[model samples]
Target: MNERIEDKVHFTQYISVPSPTSSGRSAAWLAKNWHLLNHLVELEATTLSVSARIEESIRGRMLNVVVHLCNVEDDTDFTELVLLSLSSELVKIQSISADYIEREVRCNLRGRRVTSDENDEILKEIMDALEKRGVRIDYS
Candidate 1:
């Protein structure tokens, strides 16, 4: 028996920001920064997700920003954008990292078996750059 397999790779980065007191301010801030983020990343199409939630601690509300990139080559540009955007005092950035990998596999028996490896070197370089900028990466 033989099997054929296909693999695909994807990278995702998450940013957690503390929301301001007023909802209006939060909305305005996200809108403005989202535009700036798109400009900085310079991607043909932006893949950014923004959500807000209320926190029980002194930090009233929090915004969770998720950026998904289909190409590993864009890792450096995305990380640099995160660094630039988070430098603002209005938002408190909790963490930023290339912490997620999505794999798509297709297989068929009676074909051929195959294996593949990810771009670990590029990912490692991105992680190292983020660490140097004081961003702790979560490998989950």
Candidate 2:
């Protein structure tokens, strides 16, 4: 079967989910809300990742977060914008600080480049769908 054009569009955002009291609770929250992340991935109608990692705080507690984004292409500008959009979606996040980085990788096929706002709109739609599911993440 021929692949759909929309399937070529893909993006990701690495968000540092704020520490929420306990690491267990934060983990639980992520587990329960995985659908939100999945829906966000579906927004682009392509593959996406919003994975997380936990770091030890000064207090020895873990700060749970998904700290990296992996898109098919190395479009740093577009990736950064998608992350900002995610922060806006999860209003509970008070702040987001990410060091933008870019890497080149060999790909089998060429892809069209997309604008930042267009990427944001896809993420917005994903967040909206999650909201209707009682996820209530703000994508303002």
Candidate 3:
């Protein structure tokens, strides 16, 4: 597989999760809605984290997230995007604020790179899928 760290695409988007939760609740919400994290791409290890912010006031809509995307690369190259995180990548995402989000979105581009428009489209699809799951996270 192509494992070039420099080749991966990395981007961050501030999003708002409508659940509006407090400490413990965020993780609980994430755990409960585990199936919704990556509705577009079902990757367990890649999407299992919700940072618990303990402060004077328990607020919602403050989710510091990291989302990594990967594509299906087979001989046929079907029309499917599978969410996957290698163990190494998992370690990095966990140590950071955005748990499980790394700069590792696998793709077979023959030689070039993923354009901005393409990236936007993919993100929109992901956000849309998440919205359908009752979790509205803006990708602005």
Which candidate tops lDDT?
2
- Collision count for each candidate, in order: 2, 2, 2
Tens digits of per-residue lDDT for model 2 on 89-119?
3334343222211111111111533344443
- Report the poorest 10 consecutive residues by lDDT, candidate 3: 47-56
RMSD of each: 22.4, 21.9, 23.9
Q: Candidate 1 on 3-116: residue-level lDDT in tens? A: 222223233334334356678876876776696455434433333221212112234342222222233345343321111123322234555433331121111111311222
Positional deviation of 36 in candidate 1, in angstroms? 47
Error of 1 at 13 (Å): 44
For model 2, what is the alpha-carbon lDDT of residue 87?
Answer: 29
Supply the global lDDT for candidate 3.
Answer: 0.35
- For lDDT, candidate 1 versus 2, the one ahead is 2
Once fitted onto the true fold, the runs of candidate 3 whose alpha carbons sit more than 4 angstroms away are 1-77, 84-112, 138-140
Cα displacement (angstroms), candidate 1, residue 76, comes to 20
Per-residue CA lDDT of candidate 3, range 31-108, in tens? 875664554222222211111111111243233222333433333422333332223333234332222221222233
Winner by lDDT between candidate 3 and candidate 2? 2
